[model samples]
Target: MSTTTQEAFWSGEFGKAYSDRNNWTSAQYDDFYRHEWGITKTQMNEDCLRDLPKDAKILEVGCNIGLQLRCLQEMGFTNLYGIELQHYAVEKAKEIVKNVNIIQGSGFDIPFKDSYFDVVVTNGVLIHIAPDDLPRIMSEMVRCSKKYVWGFEYFASSLVNINYRGNEGFLWKADYSKIFQENFHQLQEIYRKMYPYVSASQQGNMDYMYLLEKQ
Candidate 1:
């Protein structure tokens, strides 16, 4: 994730276009935002967050324009920080969510120390990474989370490839939550939800979201 060719593809032109295309009308973002942030009215009342404080330490990797962070901020949760791979997205996030820290960095090699956040989250970012690089990214996500990690990504029953805007091997769908549960001894699933593609909000993914607690 040290600015590899794949990383460059994300941090470059295609990534910028992806960021720009997320400008949706509020109604279009009703159930699911473009990148699978928890924006739907129902998602606001998630059970796993019952004990999380308003000032809980939260970090979002690949947080494009900080919309997810903004949602949390509006819900009165401060102490938000986001690290994005694209320089354009970082700048956009900083500009949009002025109070949050928006840094440009890779998820594979996070800049933070171990267990630095109350919850570390990734939104639709993992599948873009090559399978060979995914282990390190997953390790970093767990390494930085003090208690919980959340993911919302494209899903398939097995590892399956999908062309991303004519770029092959750039997108994949898999049971990422299953990978976490099996690979990390301490991690346990607290919640999992899947949105069928036929739903009103067919936001690019047969999306799945999971919450893993490091208990």
Candidate 2:
């Protein structure tokens, strides 16, 4: 399995399969949104929208099934946009959040203009991006956000190499503060313990949230 194979696997059949398994019903999403992220729809809305101005523009990367869109709307966020690569997930998101501006696109190349969004948020999306492509993806995220960018992801203490048959890949154990410091002047770091049920086998593993502001 080469880089091309990994990309093809994710963009082609794997996307459909994941979306089919995860996005087909509201209940499926409710469980995932709550337990996985440690937040209910109501809580997510409050956290994302807190201290922001009225009608703030928000862009969510990899907004699967629009769970965050619905949450934001419920909390009175009017200007909401999302970018997703999976077509099935995009369709499901559209169906779920009829009013949001959801576009089918890759995170590596966001279709939005620079400094267009007030707040950009991504949950559990960055880990899937290949390590070699991370710099471009991070640059794109920083380019689009005008005020703040927040991310929730799994990070390890050391680089992890994942090998599947002939395919070999690796993910850098992201130094949250270090990464943001390179690009943003003001940054805050928060660590959270992920629930065991989400990855029962990975017992001591944890997730982190990084909130960044462009200086």
Candidate 3:
């Protein structure tokens, strides 16, 4: 059983619905990334993960359907792993992404040893975590990573709560990279990119991607 409401919500039917909606193949996501960011998803991964060995062990938290892990696989990273809160998503991921291990798990308590992976990542996942719960999940990411922590999430200078699907307390935006650095003294921000919404009316809305190396 999930220990928190947020975890419960994500592990239940709602998360399955989200997984269904985002069931894009790696090639499909390549096109979507090009349309949304003017760069391929593989290019974005290469930008942040450059210089890492092809056999470097990588883990993605909340890897719904394993699309990002598939992207990493396409880039020649052989040792890959992912954890998803939803069991349905984990099953779906296994069906689509080969060789990578995708398991049903939670970020708050990742089922791995400390420094188990060379890089630990989350894509558009943290925004759903309540602010007070962020540290627990972030700590798990840090604990499991030997060298790097990567994240892509909605960005705002300060905490901004937004109603999601007519439900309150389900989503938020904040300076996640800044927060991570503030809490984890060992982390140093190595790279960051902000991609604003493509439409003019949503100009102010943007997503932030960041890489932090542990020293």
Best by lDDT: 3
Q: Flag the better candidate by TM-score, 1 or 2.
A: 1
CA shift of 215, model 1, Å: 2.1
lDDT of 3 by residue, 26-109 (tens): 778988877776677788888878888999999999999999998889899999999998889989999989999888888889
Candidates 2 and 3 compared: the better one by lDDT is 3
Full-model lDDT for every candidate: 0.79, 0.68, 0.90
The digit string of per-residue lDDT tens for model 1 on 134-175 reads: 777889999999999988788888889888778897888898
User: Which candidate has the top score in TM-score?
Assistant: 3
- The segments of candidate 3 whose C-alpha lies over 4 angstroms from its true place after superposition are none
lDDT of 1: 0.79
TM-score each candidate: 0.87, 0.78, 0.96
Question: What are the per-residue Cα lDDT tens digits for candidate 2 across 112-135?
Answer: 899999878887776666766766
True-structure RMSD, every candidate? 3.1, 3.9, 1.3
Model 1: per-residue Cα lDDT at residue 58 = 92
Better of 1 and 3 by TM-score: 3
Greater lDDT among 1 and 2 belongs to 1
TM-score, cand. 3: 0.96
